[model samples]
Every structure is written in structure tokens, then in C-alpha cells.
Target chain A: MNQQVLIQAHQRIQPFIHNTPVLTSRLLDEIAGAHVYFKCENFQKMGAFKMRGASNAILSLTQEERQKGVVTHSSGNFAQAVALAANQLGVKSYIVMPKNAPQVKKDAVRAYGGEIIESESTPIDREEMADKIRIETGATFLHPSNQDEVIYGNATAAMELLQEHPDLDYLMAPVGGGGLIAGTALAAHYFGNNCKVIGGEPSQADDAFRSLQSGKIEFNDSVNTVADGLRTNLGDRNFPIIQQHVERIILVDEDEIIQAMKLIWERLKIIIEPSCAVPFAALIKERDNFKNKNIGIILSGGNVDVKNLPF
Target chain B: MNQQVLIQAHQRIQPFIHNTPVLTSRLLDEIAGAHVYFKCENFQKMGAFKMRGASNAILSLTQEERQKGVVTHSSGNFAQAVALAANQLGVKSYIVMPKNAPQVKKDAVRAYGGEIIESESTPIDREEMADKIRIETGATFLHPSNQDEVIYGNATAAMELLQEHPDLDYLMAPVGGGGLIAGTALAAHYFGNNCKVIGGEPSQADDAFRSLQSGKIEFNDSVNTVADGLRTNLGDRNFPIIQQHVERIILVDEDEIIQAMKLIWERLKIIIEPSCAVPFAALIKERDNFKNKNIGIILSGGNVDVKNLPF
Candidate 1:
């Protein structure tokens, strides 16, 4: 929870990332009995908040390091973010994605000039493939969540959120590998000590919640959730940081997340993927926790395959 | 044609309507051989550009008239827009919608506090039903189009586009009742005389194209486009304005529109209804016309039912 690191990340990523708007939802406010402000990172570059961290991490690399290229294992938003950022910086990107990853995401990575190496769905398999690519290409491996720079970069989203609404009583975000929530909590703690930071996790993949309860990192053998972004277990690096600043981790069922996704799409007219809907799900399912308070929720991404929307 | 009316409409609607960002695509830019700036009114309030017209028309009524409430005949965006606008203004809204309209839109209207009066699909039946409601409730009839105020309000979208990108070499927008195009053309003519204003229409409902060519209003017995928003024939008021400023009307087939809709959703991660895909259809199908030029296209709406996406 180093304040200077978050500040440095903010300064590093500010030029590349969009200062996405903080949208107020009158309907959500009424429903939650709180003034709900949505920090719309869903509208960020590469269509997700991952772009902030990816861009920051990519841009921070030295010219010599960049010439060697970068590698990462992501089957979703972070893959596209890293691909696009590396493309912008004129560096090659090697994306190690699951064999079952959506064609749309693979196509996006290719469109952004990232070379993809598909691997088995398991984390070990993907990491092994990424390691092979890194060793062969002499590229730096940028972990989606475990890296310090990535977490620091992800914190800028909360920096922007708190800067826009300083009096926010609660800050909530969806937790996957815990990069976003860990970064968000660190930034909020740095900016406002009194503000409670909450993590919204899918009930089907509630590793973060269980990990928090047990005071240890936890893993799920198989994740089953419509929110594809929250399937990953909290990383070792992110778990410790999150444990320090996060007030609580609330679990929302897949059905509730789907309902929240529809509510946001119908009312806000914003196309957010199920992952981004987790926080809204938490708010809707746990309204009493946020009642009469100024709450800020981060809409993490909008990269859902329209053809495969979980209606 | 009336500068003062346009100015007044711009002033009245400026505060309510979102000046949604013009998103550009590097990939599309290379493919189209031009810089394409998408004016995303799909992100506008009520998920459509209809909000500008509906909000301005509702707010323009005299306080006494507003006290009496407002009425409109629309089964689509206008129904939701008018309902939401009236609700915002604390005015009762009576919406005459076709019984066959999608439940999602009907739900949206209801959610916005509109009282739905179901009617037959025919324009005559809709108009009669709206009129009866207006007469019974003494409510001001806010025409979806074919009204001076509504057309003026629609023009503000183009005004904002021109202000944001003054050097736009070509402007294209979908033509339904010609409300958006008429307004856009008026703004383009005033702000960028050299700019070519093209109306994009569904080939199945090419009434606007036919009307522009024949110098008279035209009608289609049964529109057969998936673009529900562009099924209507050009309104009497809008047809004349469009005929004056529009350089050409490009007719896009339903399949092209669907493909464009998919491209926007998959590429840009924006949820746009089929009608809003017309301009992109024009770009994809008639790239030769806009190659290497600075083009501005309006994304008319994003209110499509997620379950009902043509894909």
C-alpha cells in the first residue's frame, strides 16, 4: 500500500489511458438507496480497465527491454490490453491464451498485432506456454495480476474515482486475480483512509471470499460463472495487498450478476460484460450495506461477445 | 432552414443530451482508407438520438401545456425517450405503441413511468390512438417526427458533431422518418458547406431515397429491414429539409446492416441497434465514395434487446 507507487503508476499511465467518465445512475441510486457513481473503465482504451495496467507496464519497460517484446497469459481483456499497448509502443506481444478462449478475443489480439499461442485451460499449462514463449523470444513476462507494476497501474482507476468523488463512503469493484481490487484498495487507502473498499466476487468462483475468510490464498479447481473475468483465483502478490485494505469480499450468484448486467444495459445503455456486472450485483444483493452512503463502483470492461451474451 | 429555430433547439437540448464521444478505429481507418469518426449517439440518453428530439419537444411545451402532460405515437426509441423525458420533467406521458413491439422497449417505457396505450401497427391507427389519448387527457402531442420542434432537436446532434469535428469531409446518418438526417444535414449545411451529407437507408424501406429523387414524399407498404428504427417512411416536414441538403441517399441491404451491426459490436464493443448500423453499412459497402476522406457517422441508437440481436 505504498502511496508513492500508486502516484507513480498514475503519472505513468495517465498519458496512455483514457480518464473514463464517472457516470451517476439515478435509477441505481434509487434502487441501492445510495448515490451510486460508476467509474466507467468499461469505456477505456481496449474496452476495459486492463488497458491502464497493461499500458503502464508496457510503457515503463526500457527501450532495450521493449525491443525484446513482452509476453503474458490471458484469455480475455488483459490479452487485448497488452496486445494493443505493445502494438502502440511498437513492441511485439506474445499472448498465451486457453485453447477454448473465444475466437473474438483471439481475433482482437491478432488485430492488435499480438502473436497468440493457444494452450490448455489450466493455469499451469498457460504459464508453461508463456514461459516457453518468453524464453524463446527473450521477452519479459507480464503477469495479468501478480506483477507489482500491473497492480500499481490498476490502482489509477481508483485514483481517478476518488479524485472525482472524494466523499465516497464505499468503493466496490469485481475481483478476479485481484489485480483491480488490490490496486483499487491500495489507491483508496492512500487517498482516503475512511473509505471502505469492497470486492465483488462471483459465488460460483468465490475463491477471493474464501481466501479472505481463511487469511490465505485459495484456488478453485473449476470455475463456473457467467462473469468470465472473475474466474481466476487471487494471485499471491494481490492477496496480501487486498487483505490489508479491502473491508470485505461479497459473493454474488451468477443469476444476480446476469440481472445486474441486464439492468445496466437496459438503463445505462452501456454494454458491460458479466465481469463488470459483479459490483452492481453485489450492490443489488447487498443494498443494506451501501444504504444512504455515497458508493463508487468500477465498471471493469465491456468486451463481451455480443453473439454469446448470456441472456 | 430556420437558423433561429435551430439555434434555439440547440440551446434547449444542449444540457440534456450527451455529447457522446466520436470513437475512431485505427483498423477501420486503414481499411476504409479514411479517418472515420463515429458520433456515438447510441450512448446518448435513452440509448438513442431520439432523446434530443423527445427531450427538447417535451421541454419546449409551455408550463401550462406540461402541466397537462404529453402524448406520443411510437413503438420504439421515441416511446422510451418521451417517457423518460416526461418522467424527468414530472409530466405524465401517454405512449401509443404497437402491441407487437418488443417487450424490452415496452418495459423501458413502463420503467420510465409512461402509460402505454396499445394500438394497431398501422401509422393511421397509431396516430388516431395517440390523438384520442391526447384529447382525453388534454396532453400535448409530441410528434416523433413531422414536427418543427422535434426536427430542430434532432439537428442538435449534427451541430455537436460539426463543432467537435469541423473539418469532416462527409457526413452520414440513418434515415428513418428523416428526423436525424434532416437535422444533421441542416447542421452540416450551416457549419460545413463543403461537407457532403449522405442519408443511409434500408433498401427494403427506401422511401427516403425515392422521395429525395422524385421531389415528393413516398411510402412503403411493408418495411422489411431488421433495423426497426429505420422502418418508417420520411415525415412530411423532414423530407423537404433532407431533400434540400442531402447530396445522396445510400441504400444498404438488411444483410449489410446486420453485418455492420456485428462489426460495431465485436470491434468497438458498443451495443448499437440495427438501424444505427446503416451508416457503417454505407462505409463498408460504399468505401470507394468515402476513401481517404474525413467522415462522420452517427450511431443512432443502442436500445436493441440483447436476446434479440440479429446474430
Candidate 2:
């Protein structure tokens, strides 16, 4: 919402999340021909940046609200993030996951003490299940990427990165449901000394890229990218901020995403999900434009199935 | 070498290498039943702890020796380390690699500014090529693990670990050509309040284990382990120190190594070579022996070919 709100959110989640380290590789810098600082959220508590937003959102609640518990619909990292955050904050959490979700995902949610409410594989089914639980149990429903508090919480990562390297010329993040890039945009605008924000999206699922040009939320024509995380449409809550503050959204093809992801894994020596590599791929794709600038890239997550590597 | 020597080596190489971060996972701690501190040498320059030793060994050489440059026979992380370290320190380095070494590996060496001399795929032929280079150019021949300075430099990883986590009850590493474990044993003895050193070795490449029992260097009957880095036999210089200071060596079967390596890759979200997982595998095998104690594990390297993962 504002600088003060973002700062307060960071302080609130400080006790629960990691101020994950910023790593730089000379080889990676040389490859891109730019000074690249990787804010490694892959090392975040749940192996993703969602932990920051989840912790802040849950922590921002009143005692009475927290007592009633919180609910979310996700079959991805957000499910684990909310579960772990609630478990850490001594609050009950209910996760509405698709019945056909990966068993490992189900196990992780259960391991974090969250009760899983199964739904059909459709988005409408998942949302209905979450809404039903919220009504029946008087639980608060948390959106993965659309809420103000969650966006502010996600802003803290870019805030911390700016604090460490104040001279960054551009800050970039992968465009998913738009929370991370939207939050990152707000952070860059508020805290960065003229540091602009950019977004990276899969060409197959380039709704975020499309929404910026059309000035409204847009749906993907096909959600078929290897970056499973970036297939979602932008949220109303995050779209305006993205439109007002984000400099541009770069589109990378599936081959580019896999190639960049492999390069990060090999050169940075850190595992990252395909979605996380989108921004880096964009950087590599447009290397000449950003040849000598100080760039900060947020590696959004590392929660990938290593057994099924794209490369 | 003693405390001051290790400290000096660390100081000399500090500018060239990374003081790689220490990472922990609550899940991993629960699995091992011990509070574990992972000294992430996988994040080191050239993606291995060998950088520390290679930098130190080159730095310890006299200015005249440095001008003549350094030479070594190997087709592993050490070759890259020597090249990068020498390049950074403004010294020439000649790396003798077996003719059959992977093209990617040879490219990595060349990328690091090392001159590569091809040798026959035999120990005798490799050594002869290295000797020829030394004789022709007056370059200093640096053994990958056998020499005293290299061993002392290798010890700095453990030294830094002990400095950060002085209360570690036990320090562990995978025993390869014996330099890392030997250095670790000395670091624990000198810098640790009372920390003991332990090693993990592949059961197939059980030379280190046999040498400890027979009180001499021993050759492996078969070098068929997936941990390619740990296939070498112990060196004469490091063996005596290992025998004197190392409490014991734990042998892990290949299957166990793969399982533990996957756990680390999944849980820690960090890429590591198969050899790097050996110590953690050893810890999982002997979890009961180390229950509720503070332990530190040095992740030796992260230079594995992801395309050819063991899993």
C-alpha cells in the first residue's frame, strides 16, 4: 500500500521468515554482462517467497480472527507456505487442494499441521471448497496473490534486497498471479532510488504481459508452459499496481525458460523452479539493453520436482 | 601446521574465495535427530571447497614460483580451482587432464584461463605430462591433495566452520584423496574446543577405511561408486594425520548415498555432487549415535553433471 505499510509488514514477519541471503556469481555476471545480485528466496523457510506473504498475512490478523483460523485454495507452494506460517504462529489453517494434487504436496501440507480439504481439479471447485470452509467454521480466507497484506509482505523481499544494494538500477521478478511482481514494483517505487521494476512471463501464459498493454486483467490463451507456476491470471487487486508501477513485462518462450533455469542451476549452483528463471531468461534475452547496469533478480522459489527435470 | 598457519592461510585466500554460508533445515534436523550446521562449500568459488586449498597453495608459493606458475594433473574440481585461483592471483597455471575427460570439463578449465595439456588416461602418463610441463616452463607442480600446503589450505574450510560453530560435537566430511578429512581433523583438534573428526567413504572405494585399520595407505580393490570425487586413494602426506586425528570413517553403500543426496537436493534446495552427500548419508545411517548433539557437516562441492544425476 505504502512504504510505511511495507516496512511494518517486514518487521511483523521478521521473526517468522528468513532475511534470505543475496548471492552473486562472477560467472553469472559475465554470462549476462551485467552485475547480477540474486536474492535467493529458494532458501526461504518453505523454499519459496510465498512464506513472506503468508506469514505477514496470518500475522496481520486480530487475535479473534486468528482464533477462528485461516483458509486458502492452492495445490502449490502457497499451500505449504500458509500451513507452515500458521503452524509457526500457533494458528490453525485449512488448505483446499485439488483431489488430484501431487501426493508430495498433500504430505507437505499435512506435515505442517494443516487440514486438507479436497476439491475437484477446477479453480471454481477449489474456491468453493475454501469459501464453504470459511463460512462453516468462521475462518478467514487468504488469497495467494490478491490481498493487500500478502502483497505488502511480498514487498519485503525487494525491500531487503534494496537495503543491501541500494544502487540497483532495475529489479525483476517472474509474473505469476502477479503478487510478487506487483509487490516488487511497489517496493522499487517506494524504496529504490529510481530503481525501476520489470516482470518476466512465459510466452504461453503471458497474461501479465498482455494485461499491461490492454489496461485490464487478461487470461492466458493456453496455460501450457513448463513453468507450471506462472499459468495463473492476474488478480484485480494486483493488476492496477502492476500497471502503474511496473516498467515492462518481458516474454520468454518455454525453451528459454528451461535454458535459463538450467544455467542458473549450473552456474549459480542453486536449484530454482522454472517460473523463477523467467526473469533471468528475459535478462539474457535482452542482454544488450541491460549490459552494464546493476541488476537485482529475485529467485522466487525452489520447490520443483527434481525427478522430472526439464533439461 | 598449527592454528596460526591455518589462520594465515584463510587470511591469504580470503579475498579470492567465498566464506560460504552455513545453512540448516528444521526438517533435516528432525530427520537426523541432531542440530546440524551445514557449511555450504557448494557455494564456494568454482562450486567447491577445493578453491580454498588451491588459492592458499598458490598464495603460499614464493613470488618467483608464482611467476613460473603452477601445474597439476587432474580432471576434476581441482583443475578448475587451480585455474581460477591462479588467474585471480595473476599467475599462470597448466592443468594436465586425461585425453578422455569430458569436453564440458575441459571447456570449464579453459574458461577459467588454465592451459590444458592432454595426457593418456593413466596415473603414470598423467604425472609424466605434468612433470614435462614443470620442467619446460619451470612451473611448480601442485598435487591435488598430497602436498602440505594444499592440505593446510583444505583445512581452512573446517577452520572457518569451527570458528562459526565452535560448539560442534563432531565435524564430518567425505574422505577422498584424504586432504579434506585430514585438514578437517587437524582443524577440529586445534580450533575446536573438543570437537572430533569423522569421515564418510564409499563402501566400493573403501581404501580410506582400510588404510585407517592397517595404519598405512591402501588402494581400493574397485572404484565403482557413484560418488566420482571419492574414488581416489588416500595420499601419503594426509594419511598419517588422518590416522592420528580422525576418530573413525563411516562406509556408506551407493544406494544410501543416492537417497541422502536426493534428500539434500530436495530439502536444502542446494545442488551438491554425489560425494558431497556422503557425509550427510553417513550421518543418517548413524543418527542414533549423534542424537540431540550439535553437529557440523561440510558440503564439500556442487560440481556434479546434472544431466547425469544418480537419481
Candidate 3:
């Protein structure tokens, strides 16, 4: 990735993305045996950090490009982010989501004025449908993660985190398609190498860990985890960035993540989805690894269907 | 109330309470025909603004008073706030809650290291039970709102809000025992009387409005609102303050409060309890009255059990 592009991403997305609060918790610090500062991307626009990348990608489009409209294949936060961002820019959004996607998420996408095209469950099917839609509508396809603009946009969170806490010894975030962590790593490296960047993945979907070990992008045949947000494999563009800047990848079990989620809700009174709890789970599972460190944890999202709480 | 005591309350609870984010929605603004700034006390410590009073009351206690422990009768946010604040201060807490209180709230009180003393449903029965416990254990009974210290603590949120936006044209908050609105009125008056302070009450439990109108405290025979936090009548100490400072009391139907709760959750992605949504309900119901005004609305709490959403 060009350094200029990342810098441009920071400048372009500055006005669009919220500089979300960095919250410190004495209770969380005691539990983690470290001073932990949470960069609350869960409180970001669209209720997730995905808005940073989606808004950046959408806004980066030329006037003519926006006139033709934009398309993406996502059933989750990115779908809502793209739709909302496009709506804000007065540009049409064509979203390809799986038929089985949560109704709440689908409703949110449509409410943001997106044109939804439902497809089969698989990513291949969603991508194929997106391609068909793009061909028919002459829309620009904006990949959720495997796009340079998206990675750069995701980096904004890390930039803000590091700017707030320059002496942060360790940085951790949950990994899904590796977009957020990959971008965070790039930003951490750009800011300073002293701040070690790590990715936390659910043990049920440990493709990121496997991919990092083998130094290649790995695909999961099937994924099952209560954390609906972290079920995807690393994307093509994000894998290399992760390899370059991420210190290590840790896997946390479903039980640990649920416990973390409950802890956040009960103690911190912050409602975060299971994916956002993965970093806290990683800390609890590997306490010795982060003891007494000045840690920065990115709470990825807060878009949970309250009715279906695992607890 | 002593002038010095009010000033001291301002100093004591100012740092602990989150000036709480003032969130504005273009959609809600358009709908209300006003620029609404939501003061999110729901994000306050213990997931309620009650923490401000609880923490202040606990902190204000003499060392000898604290050594005797603290007791309070509450089945809701006050119980949890007292427990959490006392636990933080390393003081023992004795919470008297009705046996039929929500298990989630009771459990939360227990989780915060509070010793629960179950009583009958009525306030008289709970108070009798609390007095018994207070005498037997030599615990200081921290009245939820019918006390000067607690009201002062609740005032800090308003103080901060006025400081942030000095030219706020109008201020609104839900009325439950009138403590929050009373404190808010005091703060607003101390800052400036140019800003109108309106109390929002559920039509099902409009005792505050009735009490203000009749020049005497009035109690509802039965309360029936989804806003569990706003069911109580005005307190002895708080009623006078409300009569003196509150400009108008607006009553919203239960359904309006529900709709407001859903709107906050769906549009803003913030989980607010029905009680907290009352002010927004007023905004929605009385849109014409507030049109073109710079409105400040206090979202008092977010402690609703997400697993059992009313919607």
C-alpha cells in the first residue's frame, strides 16, 4: 500500500468519521492486570468501525463515480455503513446481502436508503449477485475489506488511538475479514513500532491464526461461532498487511467471549456484540501475556440483536 | 437547601459524572422541528444518572457515618447505584428491595456487593423493613431522593450540560420521585433561568404533574408504564424544588415513550431504558411547542435488561 494513500485516507475520512471517545476503566484494568484504554469504535458512526472504511471508500469516489452509484456484498455492519455513507453523500447504494441475514441488519440497511439484492448464504453467491447487480446498474463495486480504500479507512481508528495514547505498549482488536486489524496494524506501524499490534480471533474460526502461521491467506470450509461478526476468513488485500504489521494472533473460545461480553454489559454497562468482546476474551484467556502493559483494545461494534442475547 | 451545600454538591459530583455526550440526530431534529441535544446519562456510571447522587451521597458521608455502613430502599437504579458506589468506596451496602422486584435488577445489586433485604411491595413496607435493618445494623439510610445530598448529586449533570451549551433554550428530563428534574432545575437556575426547564412524566404516573398543580405531593394509586424507572411519585424534598424551578410538566402516553425508546435504539444505536426515553417522547408528542428551539434532553438511564426488550 502506498503511504500517500493511507495519509490521504486519514485526511479524506476525518470529517465523516467520529473521533470516538477513548474510555479508561479501573475495573477492567484490575481484571486485565494492565492499564487498558478502550477505543470505542463500538460507539462509532453506524454503531461500528466499519463506517470509517465505508465512508472513506464512498467519499473517495469521484463525482462521476458517485453518479454511477456504488455496490458492496455485506450482510452486517459494512452493509449499513455503506448505505448510510452513500445516503449522506446523496449517492445511490446497491447492497448484496445473504437471504439469511438478520432482519434487524437488513432493515437498518434499507432504512439508510440502500437498494438491497438478496442472494444465497455463501459468500460466492453474494459476490456473484453483487457482480450481476454491478453489471446491470453500472455501479462501482466497493469490496468490504479486500480494497485499498477500505484498509486505509479502517486505519483511522488506530491513528486516533495512537494519537490519544502515544505510549500505548500493546494494541489489540478482533479479526473478521482482517480489515480492521490489518488497517490498525498499518496505522500502529506508521505511528510507531513500539506499539505492538495483535489480532484476536474466535477459536471456532481460527483461520486468521492458521493463515498467519502458514504466511498465507487460509479459508475456512465452514464457520460456527456465537460471534456472528468474526466468522469470515482474511481478505486478499488485508492478509499481507496483517503479515507485515501484526505482532501475533490469539484465539479465544466461544465461552470466554460470552463471558467477556457479559462482563462488559454487567460491569462496564456497555453493550458490545460478541465480536467486540473477543479482545477482552483474549486478555482473560492469556492474562500472563499482557500483565501490567499499557494496552489499547478496540471494541469493534455494538450492533447486537438484543432479543437473541446468548446470556 | 443551603447555598453552600448546593455549591459543594456541584464540586463533589462534577468529576465522577460524565458530562454525558450530547447526541443530535438530523432525523429527530427534523421530526421535532428543533435542534435536540440528548444528554446521555444512560452512559453514566452504573448505567444511570442515579450514580451521581449515590456516589456523591456516599462520598459526602463522614468517616464515622461510612464506618456504620449505608442502607437504601429501592427496587431499581438507585439500589444498583448505591451498591456500586458503596462497593467502590469500600463501604458495606444494605439494599432493601421488594421480593417481587425484577430478578435482573436484584441480581445486579447483588453483583455490586450489596446485601439485599427483601420486603413487601409497598413503599411503606419497604421503608419499615429498611428502618429495621438500619437500626439493627447501625447503617446510614440513604434515601433515594428525599434527601438534600442526593438531589445535589443529581444536579451535577445539569450543571455540566449548561456549561457545555450555555445558550440551551429549553431543558427536559423524565420525572420519577422528581429528584432528577428537581436537581436539573436547580442547576439550570444556578446557571441561567433563561432556559426553560420542563419535566416529562408518563401519563400513567403523572403524580409529579398533579403534585405541582395541587401545591401538595400526590401519589398515584397504581402506576402502569413500560418505564419502570419513572413509576414513583414525587419525594417530600424534591416536590418543593420542582414547584419552584420547573416551568412546565409534560405528560406522555406509555406508547409514545415506547416509540421514543425504539427510535433511540434503532436510529441512534444507543440502548436506553423506557424511563430515559420519556424526554424524547415529550419532544415527539409536543413537537410544535419545541419547534426551532435549542432543546437539551436528559436520557436518565440505560439499565434495561436487553435480553427482555419490551418491543
Residue range B94-212, candidate 1, lDDT tens digits: 99999898787788899989999999988899999998988898999988877878888888887888888899999999989888898888888877749889988999989988887
Tens digit per residue, CA lDDT, model 3, A228-278: 888888988899889988999889888999988887765565668889999
**Which ten-residue region of model 1 chain A has the weakest summed lDDT?**
A20-29
Deviation from native of the Cα of residue B295 in model 3, angstroms: 1.8
> What is the C-alpha DockQ of each candidate?
0.55, 0.83, 0.36
Residues A257-289, candidate 1: write the lDDT tens digits.
999998888667677889998998898888986
For each candidate, give its TM-score against the true structure: 0.94, 0.99, 0.90
Instruction: Summing lDDT over every window of 10 consecutive residues in candidate 3 chain A, give the lowest-scoring window.
Output: A262-271
Q: Report the lDDT tens digits of candidate 2 across residue range B117-196.
A: 99999999999999999999999999888888888888889888888888999999999999899888989999998898
Name the lDDT value of residue B124 in candidate 3. 96
Instruction: Report the Cα lDDT for residue A113, model 2.
Output: 88
Name the candidate, 2 or 3, with the larger TM-score value.
2
State the lDDT at B186 in candidate 2. 85
Winner on DockQ (1 vs 2): 2
**Residue B274 shift from truth in candidate 3, angstroms:** 2.8
- Give each model's whole-structure lDDT: 0.87, 0.94, 0.86
